[model samples]
Target chain A: MPTADHATGSYPRTARTTPTRAAQRASWDRERVHGILDDGYLCHLGFVRDGAAVVLPTLYARVGERLYVHGSTGSYPLRTASGAPQGLPVCVTVTHVDGLVLARSAFHHSVNYRSVVVHGTARQVTDPAEKAAALDAIVDQAIPGRSADCRPANGKEAAATAVLAIELTEVSAKFRTGGPNDEPEDRELPHWSGVLPVSVSTGAPVAAPDLAAGVALPSYLTAQRSTNA
Target chain B: MPTADHATGSYPRTARTTPTRAAQRASWDRERVHGILDDGYLCHLGFVRDGAAVVLPTLYARVGERLYVHGSTGSYPLRTASGAPQGLPVCVTVTHVDGLVLARSAFHHSVNYRSVVVHGTARQVTDPAEKAAALDAIVDQAIPGRSADCRPANGKEAAATAVLAIELTEVSAKFRTGGPNDEPEDRELPHWSGVLPVSVSTGAPVAAPDLAAGVALPSYLTAQRSTNA
Candidate 1:
C-alpha cells in the first residue's frame, strides 16, 4: 500500500525504482524526491570501471529535476563521459539516518532513515550557459546564499573542471520513522527499547588562518548555527 | 610523503590506492583506516549488475580487518554472492563529513570529511561461529553495548539472513580539515571565509508504543544523549 504524494506528480515506478523491502515506505513523489535531495550536500556516486564497480563520495547539487556533480577534468571517470555515444550509466544516492531503533529482539533492530536513489544515464555538460548555472546551483546548495557571495570562476578555472548532468527521471525515496518494532513475545524483556533520534548539527564557525582582516562571519553562516543542516 | 602507522605495518600504497587529488591528505595507516571505519555505521556498497554499476546504502560493521554486511536471503545481491566461486567483487566506502568550507573563491570551496574505501572480493560467511559473532558486532556497531541487551536471533531468523565478509586488505582513508583554501589574490574579497563543523548528535529517546510497564531508559542510552554519536 504505497502512499500518494498529494503535493506533486508521482514519478512512474520502474523495475529499478521499486522497493524490495517495506514496500509501503517507498515513495515516487516529485516533492518528496526533491526535498530529500535538497537537505543533503554529499552523495555516493557508483560507476563501473574495468568491469568492476567503484563507489566514490562526492559533493552534488540539485537544480529543478537535474543534478550536477563536478570533478577535475583529469579524473578518469569524467573522461569516460566525454566521447561516449550513449551516456555513462550511473547510480546516485543520498541517505540520512534519522534515528536508531533499539528493539528487544536483535532481528528487529533497525534504523530510521530517509534515502533517495536516482538511476539514469549521465552525460557531460558542454553548454557554457548551463554549466555556469549548474556550478552556481552547486555552491548555493552548500550554503543557501553562497553562490552570490563567492567570486565566479574565471576562464582557466572553468576549463579545468568537468561537470556531469543527471536528469531525475527514474527516482525513488524511502523512509522509516517511529519507535522499535519488537515482537509480541519480546515486549516484556528487560532490554530497553526506543528510538534515539539522530541529527547533523553545525558547530561554531572557525575563521581561516589567512582570512583578511575586517571580514567576520556573515549573517547567513550565523543563521546556520540554529538550523539542523 | 605518507605517514607510517607506528603500531601496525602500513598497507603499501599501490596505484589504485593513491588519490588523484590532494595526495597529501591520503593515508594508508591501519589505525587511521580503522578509526574512520569505526566512526560510521553505514556504508555504500557498489557492485556491477548487467554491466551497469549500482550502489546501495547498507549497514556495515567492522571487526579488525574484516567488514561484515548482511541482508535477507531473498535479496538479489545476496544471491549473487553465495554461488560464485571467487565471490563478488565489490567496493565498500564509509564517509563522515565534518564541516563545510566556505571560500572567497568558488573553486576552493570544499568539505572537511574523513572517508575509507575498501576494495576486495566479498564472500558469504558460512562458519556458524563467525556468523554469530559478526551479527553481534553489527548490532553493537550501531549502538554500543546493544548486542547484550537484545535477544539472540532464533534459528528461524538466522536462516533467513545472509552475511558477507570483505577483507580490508586494500584500503585507503582520505580527509580534508581546517578552513577553506582560497587563492592568495582572493583572500581580501569581502566574502566571509570559514569552516562550519558538522556532527551527528542523539536526541531524547522515544519509548515504543507498546512498551511494557517499568522498562526505564537504560544508563547506556541515557549516556548517548550527552555524546556526539
Candidate 2:
C-alpha cells in the first residue's frame, strides 16, 4: 500500500477535521482507496469564491502518492491560486458508482459507490520534469497505452498548460457495496428487490482511418479491452 | 425545445450570458442543455458552510419544468435551508464524458464531455402533491419503469422523505464532443490518435431469489435491459 507522507510542510487547517465530520466520516484501507482512484478518470472539484461554493468538473490523474489536476491557464480559480497566500483551499473528490441498491423501502435505497475526498491547498507544480510526469499520468489515467504512443509536448505547448499537485496524505475514502438491507417487515412486501450490477468494459478499439497503414495495435493497447479494473 | 424563461426572474451572473460573445463560444441552445441534464444520473451540489465550500453527491430528477433533489430530514444542509431568507444558494452540476481526446501534443489534449451547471437557490417543497411527484421523478430517473413496477409509497413512507424543487430558469450547458483535435504540425508525429468511445448500459438484472417461482419478467423491466438512456 502506498501512503502519502506529510513531513514536507503543513497546510492551513489540513489536519483539522470539518465540524460536519464529512472530512473524517470513514477510514479506508489503501488498496480500496487506490482501486477507486485508478478506475475514475474525472473528478468534481469544490472551492469557495466570494463566500459561495462552486463546483466544477475537471480531468485528473493519480501518481504514486499525489493527484494532479490541470486546466486552461485562463480559468479563474486556477489563475487566482497561482499568487494567493493560502493557495486555493479545495476539496477534491473522485467517485465511481458500481451498482444500484434497490431496497424494499425508499429510505434505504442507495447506490453502491466508492468515493475519495482530499482536503488541501493545491500548489502549482513549477518544476519542468514534474510537470511532464504529471501530464503523462493524466494521459495514462485516461487510457493505459496512450502516453507512450503520443508525441511529447513542445516548448510552446508546455508553457500553455498549468498543472497543480495535491498530495493525497489527508485523504479519506468511503464506499457502499453489496445488496440492499430491507427491514424485516418489508420482506413480505410483494415488490421485487435486489441489486442492479454495473460495470464498464472497453469495446473493440476503432483505429483512425488516417493512421499510417502498418502500425498494428500494441500489447498495452489490447490489454485495456479485457480490463474491468 | 423547452426554453428557460428569464422573464420569471433575473438570471444570476453564472447563468447569464454576455451579449458580445464571439461565434465560436456561443452555443447556448435549449435542447442541447436539456439533453445533457437528462443523460446524467448523479449531480454535484455545492454550498457554502461557515465561509468554506462543500460539495456533495446526490440523486436528481428533472420534472416537467423543475429539477428535484431529496434527502433525509436529518441532513443538515437540506434542513438549514428551510428557514433561510433566500433559500440556500446552490450550484448543481451534471456531467457525462463521452470519450478521451488524445491530442498529439499534450497541451491540446482534453476530454469530450457534456455538462450542465444550474445556479440558483433551492426551495423546500412543502406541498404534499408536489413532493409525491418529485419522489416519482427520482425513481423514474434511476430506472425508467421503476416507479410503476413497484407499489407506490404509502402515507407513512411519503412523510419520511423531504424533497427540494428548483426551477430550471437559470441554467448553462457546456460541451466538448467529437474526436481529438491535434495541431496540424503534430499530425505527422508517430502516434496512435482517435477516440476510445465510452458508454454506459444496463446489464442483466439479477432477480431476487425470493421472487415467486416461474413468474414471467415484466415487459417494462425487460425493456430497460436494452436501453441506453
Candidate 3:
C-alpha cells in the first residue's frame, strides 16, 4: 500500500496539528501517523450536529491517506451526511494507552500512550466500487486476511450501510514512553514509582454455539495469539 | 455516597439519547451507565470551540454522576471553559471494546463493546476542597489505593491544573455482545466464525531505574497482577 504521504514523506504542520504541551512528543511524520492509526481498529469520531458537539466511538480503516468509516443508514450522522455541503467537518482520534506512569508525586503521574488525531471533512462514499473496497478494507483491518474468507456485502446490504471517506489533510501523532519525571527534591521520598505496561490482548477464540461440526479454527486467529504476546 | 439519581434511578431519554440503529442495545439505567463509566480511565471529551467541534482524549474520574476531568490551564478546551455560560457544553464518552466478532459474511462482522455517552454543561471547578478531592479521584481511578501512597499536589502544582465537572444529566449506555448474527443461508459457509475476546492486560511493572535502594512494590500493585488475569 502507498504511504499516507507519497511525495514529501512528512505532513506539513498546521496550527491544529501543533502540540501545546509536551511538544517534544508530537510528530507530523506521515509514516508515524499511519502506524498509530493502523494499530487500532476503533476511534472516537467527533462532528457537529445542530451546533452541538457529539463524539461517537466507531470502527475505521485507512487506505493510504483516506480513512473509511461506516454505519447503518438509519444513524443520525450518516443521515445528515447527504444534506451537508461538501461534507461534515469531523475530527477522528485513535489512542492506545501503553502504560501507567507512576510518580512519587500524584501531580506528575501520567499515562504512556500513542495517539493520532485527524481533522477533515467526511463525505459519504457514493461510488459502488469504492464503497465495496472500503468495506472490505474495514473488515480486513479488524482481522488480517479475513475479508477473502467471508462473503462480501450484497446489494441490499450495501444500500443499508453508509460509508464516509475522509482524506487526511491535517494529521498529527503524539507518543510518550519511558519512566516518570519526578522532581529532584522528591527523589528521597520513599514511593514506589514505575510503569505498568498495558496492551489490548486477545484471548482464546470462542466458537459460536452453532458453529458447523467440522470447521477448524483458522490459522490467522491462532497466529494472533502468538503475536499477542 | 449519593447515587446520580437516588430516587428515579434512571436518566431521562431524549431524541439525542436514543439510538437510531441497534436501538435494543441502548439503556437509560443509571447503574449501567455508572458501571460503564467506572470501568474505563480514559474518555473523549467533545466541546464546541469557535463554532467548530473539538474532541480531546483525557483522563477522567467518575464520582457519583459527576465526571471530573482536568488539564493544563493553557489547553484550548480548558481555556474555553471559563467563557461559556454556566459551563461549557460538552459530551463525554467512554468505551471498552470487549471482543471481535468474525462472521461468515463480512457485512455481519462486528465488535462487542460497552459504551457510555453523557451530554451536559461542564463548569469550572473552583472550590479548593472539591478540586483536591476530584484530583484524588482522578489519580485513584488509574490505580486504586494510589492517592494515599503518593505526595499530594502542592499549591504550585494545583494552581496550574484546571478541573471541569460535568453533571451526568443526559446519559445513556450502549452495549453489544454474543456471537455474530450471520444470515441463515451463510451459516453453512466454509468459513471460521466466532469471537476473539479482547482485554486490557498489564505486564509486570518496571520500577524506575533511579529508584531508592529498598523501596518495595506496593501490595496494590501486586494485587493488580492477579486481577489482570
Tens digit per residue, CA lDDT, model 2, B1-229: 1344444333333423321222243345556666777776678877776666667777889875578986655565678677775788877878776666666666666776777777678888878888877887887787666676565667877776777777776676667766667777777767766666565555666765665455455564565442222
What's the candidate order when arranged by decreasing DockQ?
3, 1, 2
Q: What is the DockQ of each candidate?
A: 0.76, 0.47, 0.82
Task: Quote model 1's TM-score.
Answer: 0.94
lDDT of 1 at B168: 79
Candidate of highest TM-score? 3
Better of 1 and 3 by DockQ: 3
The best candidate in terms of lDDT: 3
TM-score pick, better of 1 and 3: 3
User: Candidate 2 chain B — worst ten consecutive residues by lDDT sum?
Assistant: B17-26
Residue pair clashes in candidate 1: none
Model 2: residues >4 Å from true position, as ranges? Answer: A1-25, A224-229, B1-26, B154-156, B212-216, B224-229
Q: How many angstroms is residue A73 displaced in model 3 relative to the true structure, after the best TM-score fit? A: 1.0
Worst 10 residues of 3 chain A by lDDT: A220-229
Instruction: Estimate candidate 2's alpha-carbon lDDT, on a 0 to 1 scale.
Output: 0.68
lDDT score, residue B165, model 1?
93
Q: List where candidate 1 sits over 4 angstroms from the true fold.
A: A1-8, A225-229, B1-8, B225-229
Could you tell which candidate, 1 or 2, scores higher by TM-score? Answer: 1
Best by DockQ: 3
Which stretches of model 3 miss by more than 4 angstroms?
A: A1-6, A225-229, B1-5, B225-229
iRMSD of prediction 3: 0.9
Q: On lDDT, who's better, 1 or 3?
A: 3
